[model samples]
Target: MPSPEETVKLVQQSMAVYVKPREQAEHVRRVIAYHLQSTVEGSRPGGPLCLIDASANISEPYQGIRGATQEFFKASAANSKALEEFETVRKAHTQLNQPAGPVIKPNRYEILDDKLHLINQQEKSARLGTLERHIDILSEKPATNPDFLSLKPIFKDLRPLVKVPREIVDSLAMDENADRRDLASLVEKLDKVLLKSKLLLTREEQYLQTLKSQISLDPRSVTPSAKARALDTTRNELINWIESELSKASTNADDSDAGHDSDSSHGPSTSGEKPGEEDEVAKKTRQTIMTKLGTVKESYQLYVAARKSLVAALKEPVSMSARPVAEPPVRQPQESPATTEGSSGTASYLLLPYLSKLSELTAAQKAVIAYKSHFNVALAKQLKEACQIIDHLVPESQLLPQFPWPASERAKHLNPGSLDHLTAAVSDQPDLSSQIKPWVFASDSARIATMETVAESIEDGQVGIESINKTLTEIASLFGEVNGDSASISQGDPWADLALDLGLLGPKPRP
Candidate 1:
């Protein structure tokens, strides 16, 4: 029910409510990691690996927060999915309005009634002749004509519903029957004979109603203006539903966050390490990491906002000229101005509105494209920076469990005798994260090969802007951008599928 502008504002506000707290939680995790890294830097050989305990304590709760945030974003992404569905339905409605040639089928009930009347008339005529011949003293021949041919075709059209065998109906028509009881028996069963026919007619009516509703046209009655209004109402309701869901999700997030905060306050510190033990450098590192995390989070929020704004803008109705223009009549060599003046004047008036709307829509389209391109470039850069920081700080060798990578070359350095000591020792290695990536590749060689083939097959500029952004995010999340390069090798989701959905490529045509 809300206006488009109001709905967009509500969505933005709802997203922000969920996003802000999540950003804070992410910042806290980064701070803990930064401080632990500083502690690891200063620790002596053979001494306790105290930083490991700090990392473990912070990680458990942060994992929960991260999961909640991911769910919130996933729910928010549903709005985009809803919009896509609306667009598909809208397109189908547009197709329904397009000029289809004259239909062969009329109201099924009308056709059936007419066929029944013709058959009944023949039966009545034959009966009258039989009765008349009963008292005939003045006839040369008591002619009894039973029209079996016409009745047979009508019965055939009714199909399995008209269960009377062709032979039985033919016998009733061709053979003269004077007994009223015999003729009455066939007349009485006609309703039973057309039971399936009635059911089929009902089904046809229901189907027609479905098509009418989908295209926002009334089956009972419809005019051009009424159809347009119906379409507008449908569009508004879809947008309203999207906004309502977003609002509900935001409210639920707030309630969940409130409970989480209450529990955190009452709960004892779950960290392995005691508090007040971190050095000055470790404390400073925590503060610095928090600041950087905030910056990254803000950049991400900005990116999300821009994308939503584009979606909102696209939802507003584009004034399309739906009616077809008739081709102008060919002019005689010396046609008078007055003769053509009325039609030409009318066309000019119609075209002015259409051309104006087209120009406006075109300009809006260009603006949207420019904005999206710029935003994507910025977002890609931000993702690259964030990934670099995460990769540099979090040691992947320490992250993975030992059993899963027993024979992995990356795990060879990890000793069973002093697992904790080995973990801490490997965390210091500069190339440890880089080494882990090779292990991933080795483990998922077949999947990697498939993904690579898909990526290679995809031609450039084939993917939709939205899908491309999503793909980039997935890539960054799984395998952070390395060496300032935005390109990444994905372990899931073929790049070719994304291109195919965008209509840039399709299945190869058969010969």
Candidate 2:
């Protein structure tokens, strides 16, 4: 087989022969044609080896070209195989490194072809990519009617050497039609997956809201407000109970009156006075008075029950609204541990409890921005809503004073000149009574249970995004690298050498 250098020289010579005078064109055509035909037929059944040897002797230039073309194909196949192997390795490396580092691997094969040798170690894929462009130039080569048949053999022999792979050819044939169908199918499947996950996430969120409402209504950790509500409910139920009893009493009274009337009609005066009989109107009035008295008693019972519930809740620590003790009893205290500790240390202890909450809020803010920028608009919106809920529940404004006390007033309160001075300084500061308790979410066990449900749903959404992101990355990588187009060719044919060198004529491969 001819080396790559010889291939280049042979191609130059062939082109040179093509552009020569008319007489020379025919001679060159016959030489190249006969040489290619003999080479191709050498493997045929009953083909004579002697004739093949003789054909070589008839034309040295044609013989050189045939050898070069054949060698070119052999080298190309070897290079192509090497590239494929390296590509697999590269992909493995890419997977290992993932989201970072180098992508392409180093040269795995040494190319000896002159035209391709310019390909450097760092640019192996790039240099090898030129083969398609060169093939394109070859396909565009021209052929006139006079020498078309003579040149046909040479063209036919070289065509298969650089032919596009069967798969690529098939792809090109169906790209416009089949590609759309395949993409549509893939998109539909992915969309279904996305929609299903999205719905699941939405359901989880709704369930989380339900959990919050349940937590809000939980009887365990009852606050003062909740106790009041319970009292009111009890009062209402008692009133209903009283009304029911009165209705029963009224019904009994009506039955008794009808009985007395029937008795009077049956026996007018068995005795001077009756034992169980009375005037119907008087009896009805008496029944009405009793019913009214029963109603009043029921109302009194309801009021007593409600008042007792409130008083009992106030006495128990089980209630969340139980007032805190400002100072514990100091029996035989020679500076209690809390009083002895450094004020700064105590302050830091107080601050530490809130740090985690601050961190969570900060992280959620970043998540909101990241999801929005990453094209997950719905998730971003959801996160934003969550943030709003958090802010509303634990308003930052309520945690600190709108305006702080002046230094003079602070000093006066810290070291009072007199009781009147101390009182004045305290009065100058913001009203402590006006500040309501800060809302706490996930602070109590019941609230935390509800918030955990929300957290679980958020995690599910995150998992879904990660899964979809992986698929999207794979789709993106499919189009990451592509072969470049070949340089433009001249408009018309002129010199035979130039035409043949460009691969414009003879059987050249299409891109």
Candidate 3:
């Protein structure tokens, strides 16, 4: 049992905790007494009663007395319980069970949290003064809304893939140059250019979302399933705006006229443009967003791959003692990755090849996206060029292992069929020329599946079908060994033509 002395401390604290309410009650009494001042005379010069005499109270010091009729007047037990809890906690800290010396633990907001939750519930249930009920379309962003885009919230990482703009992924498809450092340089010059494409894109997305939100207020605006839509800034911003509008819309009636007026004013222009066209615009918006994201992602991947390779090269690799005597190093004036080795027999400066191939792959991805979105005559040529570069890189890329069969049958299985190094570090990564992203594409994937089916359906070429099936099942497979450049193969003798297709040797064949 807590003693009377501890109860006294509880009473003191209880009075202090409710000092504000006491003062407020005193003010109310003074206002009432002034109104009734002439009705009654005090027994003494100034004595306390329904008629509050301020002069009488000023004559004596404050006694920390509370009125007998207050809600807190009977809270002694509760206050005593709280005081014991504090004392126990303090004793735990001291480990000596001593009396607590003024333990000050303000409420940790659990009660405040409950009150806030109640307020949110009330807001959601509150009827709007406007045509909007809590159930109305104007009362936006309900959990059950079908239009809601299920984008995972983007939280920036602690150690993000840094030192590159996010939009380089878009440039990967568009940039003709194998070196993507130029794209980096362009991004570096942000805000210096007046009214650039970046500003236009930002403004267009804003206006587009504004238009869509207005259209959605109407019941007829049925949209396609947003399930396939990837995470994007426009969708994120649109969701945030809806939440803000809903929060502001409450039981207040005056806000109804304001919202109605704004909608009426904008209705003409909004209706002027058909709502169905907005999806196409949204598709473009997502693509724009994807480009920036893809660029950042592809750039980071390239950075990681290059960084890993460079780190490995900096280390002393063991002698290739098991292989044929390794080729001698050819020193370049400036360090180049083309050189096989250093005087120390360790690899040197391996970031260049990855950087080059990464840019080429990005270009190919961009081409694919462009062709898929809305194919044009210009994109056809772009795709061809990108495909050629990809073909050239496939053989040269140390990222890929050498073909199993060496040059002709003479050197067959004698060679290691790969560069000296085919480490797990390389195997873990996807193809250097992998696609980043684009608008929804079914043609290529569907076409590939169709081709496989057609190939399997050919019962006459059973042996060929089995061979093709085996090759298809392999992780990476190709038709045949392509020897020499296209030009060399085309112009030279049939034997000299190597397996490579020569542009000069043939007119275009029908697809």
What are the RMSD figures for all models against the true structure?
62.8, 47.7, 48.4
Give each model a TM-score.
Answer: 0.16, 0.15, 0.12
Give me candidate 1's TM-score against the actual structure. 0.16
Candidate 3 is scored at a TM of 0.12
Full ranking by lDDT: 2, 1, 3
- True-vs-predicted CA distance for residue 234, candidate 1, Å: 28
Query: What is the model-wide C-alpha lDDT for candidate 3?
Result: 0.47
State residue 277's C-alpha deviation in candidate 2, in Å. 8.2
**Best of the two (1, 3) by lDDT:** 1
Clashing pairs in 3: 169-295, 172-362, 172-363, 173-366
Best by TM-score: 1
Candidate 3 weakest lDDT stretch, 10 residues: 431-440
| Per-residue alpha-carbon lDDT of candidate 3 for residues 1-511, written as tens digits (9 for 90 to 100) | 4676996686578557544576897896675455445334432326554433222323232356444322222343344545565667566545644555876666869879989999988876663533455456545656565545444333433455566666776766665756766776686344223223444455568879999988745544533222212222233334334434634543232355456556656666778765446545655665675577556545544543454344444353468667454343333322332222231122113334665899999899667645543443344346557667767755665433422222453233223463312421333322222321110123344556679888877764898778886776552324334434422334434544233345244443223
lDDT of 1 at 377: 49
**Candidate 1, poorest ten consecutive residues by summed lDDT:** 51-60
Provide the global lDDT of candidate 2 against the true structure.
0.54
Superposed model 1: Cα runs more than 4 Å off:
1-338, 396-511
After superposing all C-alphas onto the true structure, candidate 2 shows an RMSD in angstroms of 47.7
